[model samples]
Target: MRSMLLRARRLLGALLLAALLAPAGAMAGPCGPYTTGNIPDCEPQQQAPVPYGILETQGWAYYCTGDHPYFWGLSSSYPGDFTWDNSCFSAIENVFPETTPNKFDATFTNWCLSAENIVVTLGCSSQPPPGFGPSCNETGGPVGDPGCPQSNISNHCSSTNPPVCFQTATETCSDGTTYSCTADQGIVWCYKCG
Candidate 1:
């Protein structure tokens, strides 16, 4: 009778061990049926597109004492022609002189590009802060600042399947000045200021 109890206990332990280990083994098995050589015939992994946009930094210039700077502008992205406009001004609390006397810096965070193109423009107002003139060359152009008066900027994909994405844009002012900006993996990689 004692031997029978021992056998039953051993069987129960073996069953429990198998129960605990079965799920792990199943998880380790090939995703699909194995080939004749026992190699996994798995399907190729599909890569999903990561949606993103471009962010432009504009409006960094020298400021006069007690003279707050303002940034007012419009930004747009193409392949879909989405647009955004904003106005930002410096208050006594936020405006301060930089280490270089009479110099202040500000940025324009507008527009994003998921796929194709991005266009950003600064200096929309006629009375922009001193030292903050229209950087783009705008000859014979419209009266007021026509935000980034350049042509269409393009972002090309490297591959179709699991495509590598890049975002870029060029700002050409009326004065024949140029600035280039690029984005990779949802972050601005380089922004060449005029």
Candidate 2:
């Protein structure tokens, strides 16, 4: 009888230790209420288009001060759902997605987290996201462009999207100008290094 009792005690202790040492993701469920200074227990994750546009993106405590950091813009075209964690203080609303779609995300499908009158964006990984690249170069012209005229957006070596993510603005133009100190809007060919 004493031996049996001792064995049971040992088993219980081992089980408790195993539970404590298990991986964080093993239990499953949200580790949210994720806020500016709160790091939830779950692992950071970004998964999208799993079962067809089933977007899911979550991140723990990360200090961000810019609007862009909170603004999770879709990959130019893929859009879906209005989801937020508990910290956001907003409910999970579908917001009539099937009928209406808009260019600006704030209205219908922008993942915004708000706490204390502050709103931040958090985008989900899209349906497989985009592959390859999409670098934004000088959109030369399309015949009837509303005119993105010389609005201080000069021909500078820009840190554009994919295709040419990082740029080295070292071009000795025909007019004798090197680096990003040029002051003209002439046409020059941009070689893409992927």
Clashes of each: 11, 1
Q: Encode model 2's per-residue lDDT on 1-194: one tens digit a residue.
A: 99999999999999999988643233122222322212211222332321111123322221111111111122222222123333424233222321111111232222333213223333322111123112323222212212222222322221323211111132333444222211212322232212
- Candidate 2 clashes: the total is 1
Given candidate 2, what's the lDDT at residue 174?
Answer: 46
Where in model 1 is the C-alpha error above 4 Å?
1-152, 174-176, 189-194
Stretches of candidate 2 above 4 Å error?
A: 23-30, 33-37, 40-46, 49-194
- lDDT of candidate model 1 versus the reference: 0.32
| Winner by lDDT | 1
Q: Write the per-residue lDDT of candidate 1 for residues 49-81, one digit (tens) a residue.
A: 222234543443322211111222111100101
